[model samples]
Target: MSRVFVKKASYDNLDQLIAEIFTLYDINLRGKRVLIKPNMLGAFPPEHGNCTDPRLVAAVVREVRKQTDRIWVGDNPMRVQAGGGVDDSARISGIYEASQGYYVNVGAKARVISIGSEIIAQMPVSEYFLEADAIINLPKAKTHMIAGITCCVKNMFGAVVGSAKAKIHYDAGHAKRFTQFLVDLYKYFKPTLNIVEALTIMEGDGPTHGKIREGGKIIAGTSGVEVDAVVASMMGFQLNRLKFLQLASQAGLGECDLGKIEVVGDFEPWPNFELPSTYSGRPMDNIQVAQAAEIHEVWGQVGRLHPRFIEENCTACGSCAEICPAGAIALDPYPVVDEAKCVSCFCCAEVCPEAALVMPKEEAQTLFLRLNPQIREG
Candidate 1:
């Protein structure tokens, strides 16, 4: 049985807890090249709960240092494009300083490989993932607008370097397909250890924009799928509802059945925890109901949303233009969108570090309903 450990934790005192977890998991990094991958989603600060806490990252680095000096800390933030730098997000999120000078721009180099998924045949993955002897995945505990919860399993998507992420989203075309693609990617690049930063978690619409809530816990395990299963349970989610978790378990990547998995330490489901707006309490086996829920809640509304530029916030860095898969955005001094060429993938918005490109909820809902008249808004 896969074992998951949960500990009451705080940023102020993570060193002892981290060391204990390292020992419990028997994570040996002696004389081996190690990579510490954290969820550096964008430029959001630690207080915002968008990325892993720098203090937690620093504590992990200290623990890893005891085992090996050949350590690298990196993550391809959402704003990163091919050949683009991740330092801005890293620095802003305090991961750069917390990395203790071991940070590398992992997004700078990539190796394309055939994933052989139904959605995406081949994709470019960061070279650091290939070079590392072991990867310690540090994912923030948060709700995801698309995937339900962004925890251990979903965090590995950073392995896909730069704009290729957006292309995958565009290719998947829907929520279920996109989640299946995540499962395929996870199977290819599973991490050696998974740790979650749950001291401060995100709720409502997240993985980016959301409300912050206190969790006061740190969870660790060897298997990402098992770790996520524990996290999903703690967050009051019915594990089967999360498509990626279900697919990962079915693929034999890891155990999702909580009854079969062993849990260490005091664990209790959070009381009345808020889930993403996209989350549906209904059983996923009903295809018609699931499709309608996806359309009304996630894909139809969030998928059809177009980028709305904030002129004052735009620095004309051309990041949005550079990362647009359809070449829909152009920097006409302040950046302009050619709506015709835009595929509504929202890659441009995700890659914008300045937060200039935004998707308004009302506007997105209006557009989605207008485009598809048959699907009435709930």
Candidate 2:
């Protein structure tokens, strides 16, 4: 059984919380090549709960400094706004200062590797990520439009640099396949430890943009799968509803069985935490390739919830169209989605800094059916 150490903490006492986990476990940081991957989605502030709190990351750096000086902190953040790169996002998110300029654009260079997934056969992973001896995954707890929740598992997508990430989404063409790809990627490129910052989390629609809710929690563990499972539970999601967690467990990577997990602190569900509008609480069955393909063709009809562009909020920056996985979104001087080709992945919404994209409540919920769980998906 994998052990997960969770502690109730505020951002102010982050070091003490992290220190407690170190005390509970034998997580050796002495003279190790440590790579810290923090959730730097874009240039969003920590208060918005869109990115990992840099203060918490700084605490991790301080803890490791006690053991070694060989440390590199970095992440390939999505270009959400015009004229902003990973450096901008890192700075705005406070990771740049927290890391003391140790932050690197790890995605700047890449090396191709076989992922062994049917949809994503191979990908160009960051060379720096592959070379690291000990990896500390710093993830912000948030709801993901596609993956249910973006924690330890979805955070690893940063390993794939540049436009290659969109290509995998296009290739997978389905949530189940995409989630399996994440599981496979974790199996191949994994971290040494998983630490989650749930002090403030994006609850409604996130990974990038959403409402901030105070969780006042810090969770740490060795297994990403186990850590993610616990986060899902905290967010009020059932294990089977999380495709990546289900796939990860099925792939023999980690255990999602609550009975088998060893938790080290207080555990309780966050009250009324809002899940994404399109999140179906129904459990997923076994991942048979043929079944996944069949589900892909018909899954969107239930919600048909695709993001509509708001011209007022749009800056004509073209980042959304560029980041669109299926190439379904195009710039006609403004961005437009080709409904026939679109898969409703909402990747555009994540990269849109202008907050121009929106899913209509009327569209997500019909008169006869509330296709979404709530009145609003966002």
| Tens-place lDDT digits, model 2, residues 75-183 | 9865633336877788888898999757788877789988676768788888888888888899999987667788998888888886677778778877777878888
Best by TM-score: 2
Cα RMSD, each candidate: 5.0, 5.1
lDDT (CA) per prediction: 0.78, 0.76
In model 1, how large is the Cα lDDT of residue 340?
70
Give the per-residue lDDT digits (tens) of candidate 1, residues 147-199: 76888877889999866788787677666678888898888778889999999
Per-model TM-score, in order, reads 0.82, 0.89
**Backbone clashes under 3 angstroms, per model:** 0, 0
Displacement of the residue 171 alpha carbon in candidate 2, Å: 1.2
Candidate 2 positional error at 253, Å: 2.2
